[model samples]
Target: MDSLTQFTLGAAVSALCLGKKLGPRKSALLGGILGTVPDLDVFLPFDNPVDAFVLHRGWTHSFFIHALATPVVGEILVRSIGALRESRARVWLTVFLCFTTHAIIDAMTVYGTRIFWPFDPDPVGVGSIFIIDPLYTVPLLIVVIWAFFSANWTSRFQSWLVAALIFSTSYMGLSIALQAHVENRAETIFADAGIDARNVFAIAGPFNTIVWKVIGQEDDRYHNLYISLFDEDDEQARVYTHPTRSDLTACLEGNDAFEKLRWFSRGYFGTALQGGKVVISDLRMGLTPSYVFRFAVAEYAAGNVRSIPPQAIEGQLTSLSDDLNWLADRFVGQPSVRAAEASGGEPYGTTETASCVERQTSG
Candidate 1:
C-alpha cells in the first residue's frame, strides 16, 4: 500500500492504544512515524536491479522480527519518554501493532511482501486490493486528523478512532471476499471456454475493488478478463487470450536472475522475443500490452539464446488518460471492445542487449 495509507493506519492504531497516557496528538505522531519503519529497506544497497526489486519488504517486514524487536523498542520508549515510563505494556502493544499492521496491509496488495521472512522467504500477496485505495484510507485519515488536533483524549474521540479502525479492517475483509467472488466468476467463465481453472487468479483493478482483472494460465496461452460486480448474471465477460511463450522458458533455464523472477511471479509470467532479444514479463501486474516488470535477460544469437545480466524494462502506457477512462467505464459494467482491440500487437519492444553466458538453443 501507499505511504499515506500506512501512516494513517499506524496513527489510528497507536492513538487507540496509548491515547490515555500520551494524549492522542503525541501517540498518533509517534505511531505514524513507526509505521514507515519497515519500508526503510528501500534505501538498502543491492548488487543488482533484480535483487532490489525482489528483496523489498523483506526482513524488516517480517512478523517474527517485529515480535522480537517489540520489547526492545517499547523499553527504549518507556525509558526515554517520561509519560510512557509507567506504561510499559501499552507501549509494547503500540509498537507491535504499528509494525505488524503495516506489513499485513502491504501483503494484501498484489505486490508481494515477505511477512514470514527467514522461516519462509516466499512472499505473501493476497492480491485482494490495489496499492492505493482512497476508500480504505480516507476514513482512517479523517479520524486520525480529528484525534491529532483534539485537546485531549475524550471518550467521544476514542470511540471515533475505534470506529474508524473497525471500518477500515472490515473494508479489508470485504476486499478479500470480493476477490474470491471475482475468482469464482472467472473460473466459471474459463471452464465454459474450455480453459483450465487451476491457475486462475483475480486482482482488484487499479484503485477500486468493485471491478477486477482476472488471469488464467495454461502451458502455451493465458486468458484475461475484466468483470464488474454490477454486471448481470447472464452477461458473458469478454475474454482475451494471449500467448505465454512457454517454449522459451527452457532457453533461459539455470539463469540465476531469470529464475529469481520466475519465483517472484510464482509462475504467472510470460516470455517474449523483441528484436531477437528474450524478455520476461510478470503477468500478474499491469494491463495486456503494458506490464509493471519486464526484463530483457537474454538475446538470440545464431539460432541460440544467450543469458545476460537482467535489465528492467519500463512499461509503456500509450495514454494514461485513455487507460483510466477505460477503467472507469469497465468499473461500471459498461463493456467496450477497446481492450480486445488493444491485444492485437506485439507486447514487447526492443532494448539494448547486455553481455554474458554460453549460448543455449530453445528446446
Candidate 2:
C-alpha cells in the first residue's frame, strides 16, 4: 500500500483509540506520524540489491518490534501531551494500534510482510490486493478526514469511523474471494488447453481488483491471462514456452548468488542464455516480456560453466507506448487485442532471448 493509505489508516485508528482523551486533531496527527515510522527501514544500508529486497519489511515491520517500541513511544506521547499525561495506558494503546496496523496492512499486499520477523523471515502475503487501489482508499479517506474535523468524539462520529474501517477491511476479504474465483478460471482455462499447470497464482490488476492477471507455471511453459470480471466473453489464454537451457543450471547447481535468488523468488523464475550468459529472471514482478528482476548468474563457455557475480539485467521492451495504453485499458475493465499484441502481449518469454539466456543461438 502507498504511504498515504497507511498514514490515513494510522490516523483513523489513533482517533478511535484516543480521540476523546487527546482531542481528535492531536490524536490523528500523532498516529499518522507513528504509522509511517516502520517503513523507515528503507533508509537502512544494504550491501546489494538482493539483500535490500529481502531485508525490507524484516525486523522493523515485525509485530515484535512494534510491540516493544509501543510503550517507549507511548511514554513520549504521554509526556508531551499534557491532556493525556494521566491516561498512560490509553496512550500506549493508541500508539500500538497505529504502529501495528501498518504492518498488518502491508502483509495484505503481494509483496508480503515479515511481520513475525525473527520467528520466521518468510514473507506472509495474501496476494489478493494490489499495492494501490483507489477503491480501498478513497472512501475510507473521505470518512477519516471527516472524523478528523469533528470537534468531539461523539458516538455517532465513532460509529462512522468504525463503519469506514469495516468497509475497507471487508474490501480485502472481497479481494481474496475474487482471487479464488480467478484461480478457478485459470485452472479451467489450462485444463481446456490440455496444459498441466504445476502451479497457478492470481493477482489483482494494477490499480483495481476488478481485473485479474493469472500466471500458470508448467515444467516447460507458462500461461498468462488478463481477465476482466465484466468481460462479455471468456478471456483467451496466452502461452509462452520457457527458455531452453544448455546444461547451465547443471553446472552452476549450487552457486551462492543464484541460490539466494532462487530462494527469493521461491523458484518462480525463468532462465535464458543471453550473450552466452545464464540469467535467472524473477517471474513474480513485471509482465512476461518485460520482467523487473533479471540477474546474470553465470557465464557459459563452449561446454564449461563459470559462476560470476550476479548482475542485474533489464527485460527487453516490445513497445513502451502501446504497453501503457493496453495497461490503461485493462485497468478500466476492457482490453484491446491489437494494443495487447503491440505491447509485448505475444506470449511470455518472447523477448527473453539475445538480451536473455537464449542469446547463444542468435545470429
Candidate 3:
C-alpha cells in the first residue's frame, strides 16, 4: 500500500490501542510514524532499479525483525518524546502490532512484502487489493481525521475505527473469494472455446470489480485472457498469445537476472522484440508503455528500422497489454506456489515461451 494508507492505518490502530492512555493526538502521531517506518527500505541503495524495486518490502517487513527490534525502537521513541513510561513489554507490543500490520497490509497488494525474510526469499503477495484502494483507505482516513479534530476520544470514535478496519479486512477476504469465482468462470469459457489449457490464474484490477485478467497456459505457450466481472457470465474473455520471436527466449532464458525478475513478477510479464533485442515489462504496474525500472534492459537505438534487436523488442513490448488482465488478476489473488500447478493442471516445466506482440507495428 501507499504511504498515506500506511499512515492512516497505523494512526487508526494506534488511536484504537493507546488513545485512552496517550490521548488521541499523541497516539495517532506515534502510530502514523511507526506505520511509515517499514517502507523506509526504499531509501537503501541497490545495484539497479530492478534490484531496488525487488529488494524493497524486505527485512524491515519481517515478523521476526519486528519482534527483535521493537523493544529498542520503542525505548528510543519513548525517550525522544518524553511521553508516558509505559511498560517495555506493552510498548514493544504496540510497536510490534503497528509495524507488522503495516507489512501485512502491504502484502495484500500487487507489490507484495517479503515478510518472511531470511527464512524465505520469495515475496508473500495476496494480490487481493490494489496498493491504493480508495474504498479501503478513504473511510479510515475520514474517521482518523474526524477523531483528530473533534478531540472527543470517545468510545464512538474507537468504534468507528474498528468498524473501518473490519470492513477493509473483510474486503480483503472477499477478494480471494471473488478470485475463485472468476477462475471457475474462466475455465468454463476456455473449455467452451476448445482451448486445452491447464493453469488458470485470475486477478482483479485496482479499484474496480468490473475488469479482470486470466492467464492460462497450454503446452509451451501462455495465453492472456481478459474478462469483465460485471458481465452476466464468462462470455467476454479475449485471448492473446505471444508472438514468435527468437529474442523472447534468448533474452529471458539462461539469464539469472531475468529468472529472478520473472519469479518476482509471478510470470505476469510482457515482451516486445524490435531491432533484434528484447524488452520485458511487468504488467502488474498498470498498462503504461514504459518499464518500471527505466534501465532494466538496454536502451532503444535511434533511427534503426529493420532487424529489431532484442532490446528494442523489449522496449516495444512495454506498450502491449497481452497479459495485463492476467497481471491484474494475479496482483489481486497473490501468487501462490501451487498456482502454476493448479492452473496448469499438470507438472510445471522450466521451458520459456516467446514474448507476445500485436502483428502490426514494431513499436
Top of the candidates by lDDT: 1
- Which TM-score value belongs to model 2? 0.85
Write the residue-wise lDDT of candidate 1 on 266-344 in tens digits.
8888777766668888887888668888887787655567877778877656677777787787777787554423554
Q: For residues 182-212, what per-residue lDDT tens digits would candidate 2 score against the true structure? A: 8898788778878788678887877788877
Per-candidate Cα RMSD to the true structure, in Å, reads 3.2, 4.6, 8.6
Residue-level error in angstroms, candidate 3, position 348? 28
With a 3 Å backbone cut-off (N, CA, C), the pairs that clash in candidate 2 are 272-357, 273-357, 273-358, 273-359, 274-356, 274-357
Q: Give the TM-score (vs. native) of candidate 1.
A: 0.93
lDDT of 3 by residue, 156-215 (tens): 878888898898778778878877787888888888888887758775665654456576
> Ten-residue segment with the worst summed lDDT in candidate 2?
354-363
Regions of model 2 farther than 4 Å from truth: 147-156, 233-235, 244-247, 274-277, 300-305, 328-363
Clashes of 1: 0
Q: Return the lDDT, model 2, position 282.
A: 71
